[model samples]
Target: MNGTLINYFFHCKRQCYLHAHKLKTEHTSDLVKLGKYYHKEFEEKDEDKKMINGVKIDKIEGDYLIEYKKSNSDVKASEYQLLFYLWKLKQAGIIKTGKLKFKDNRDDKEVNLTLEKEKELEMIIQKIKTLINSDQIPPVINKRKCRKCAYFEFCYS
Candidate 1:
């Protein structure tokens, strides 16, 4: 889970560990609830989260790797996450471009990541791995990322 998408999820390291290890979070936030709702709405009727070459792809449509985003404004992180998914999809022989956007709104304001972006995301994944191995929770003093973070309680505590 040290991929692009996971890297953007930077509120708490312990939570990241649980997610990376595929452990479910006992408590979820309203945002998580909204995402689940959106996924149910937009994902293909048969789509289920899949791990392809160690990458967790939310869904795939033809030659597109689809990853839903639920961000208030910072959409770049979501784009990077989708790039990470595409990078993994490439490894799984599902090479394709990726699109990241709000699932519920469908406002057409999307962050599209190119193959180059995927490479950039690959570099970022390395950095994230190093940071995680060091066992440090990068400060979110401004709390912008923390506000909507699902593990806010754990992070604040």
Candidate 2:
């Protein structure tokens, strides 16, 4: 139910479900570490980080809730993660647009929490809860992208 969960839910359902079940492996991931280093290195301001509902947002500046990524490897995932933050903001009676900032300098993607997207998010949340509770483990995706995932060893080995 955190932003990473939302991102992983889109990136790989198995990773998301495993994370919910506390089968964490990201700490051992070099890619993950690199992203963290990149994030800390580029953070605009310490005060911009915000915490709400137990999730840490990267930054909130003006009308944009900005999310930073090391790369645009998964744009959809990044966008949805930002959207989840926007939804959280809405719940707190704060509405703002979302911006995705890639350390690789890819063009930013602006996300708006339209009514349609809000409904989609509701469904995604329900699906995430269901996936987390289900006893069945999701099958390995076995894609090239899986090679870069923190759960790659757990899934492929």
Candidate 3:
């Protein structure tokens, strides 16, 4: 349950549940459209979806997770998201371990996650799941990162 899908809920539970369990949605933004393009570009099914699901990966070594970012400013969240994906993989028994990778053609740069920081991430996962299942919208701290979130208005309003 700790994956991109869950991370989406970390921002907005309703959105995550709607998209994951129900696949319910009609509207799509430019960012989402572009994100789909990136995912398609980096996806590699030959690697075996079942195999990659819960295996511990040292590095992206391959397309493990093609996290596309528009800038380095969002690296932290991207890493968190990727780790959550790994967690999901682990939960589903797909991957036992893996680090994050961030790529952005806009900045012509890439960042390989070196920080383990798994303990902290594990703690947050528990908290997030608790809050999400409780059916509560997390408070907005009004950070710069909130600017790009699709649910900003719904949550902050």
Q: Which stretches of candidate 3 lie over 4 Å from their true place?
A: 5-27, 44-51, 54-70, 85-116, 140-147, 152-157
Which wins on TM-score, candidate 1 or candidate 3?
Answer: 1
The CA lDDT of each predicted structure is: 0.61, 0.89, 0.51
What's the TM-score of each model vs. the native? 0.70, 0.94, 0.55
lDDT of 1 at 116: 77
> lDDT value for candidate 3?
0.51
**If ranked by TM-score, best first, what sequence of candidates would result?**
2, 1, 3
- Would you list the rank order by lDDT, best first? 2, 1, 3
- Predicted structure 1: lDDT: 0.61
- Residue range 63-147, candidate 3, lDDT tens digits: 3544444445545555677666555555665443333333464443333333465566767767656654664444555766555
- Residue-level lDDT of model 1, residues 1-157, one tens digit each, is 5453364554455555545544454346887787677766666564566778887666666656767655536565565666666666666777676766575466644445566776677677776677656655555455566667676775577
RMSD of each candidate? 3.6, 1.3, 5.6
Model 1: how far residue 52 lies from native, Å:
2.9
Q: Can you write out model 2's per-residue Cα lDDT over 95-133, one digit (the tens) per residue?
A: 899999998987988999999999999999999999999
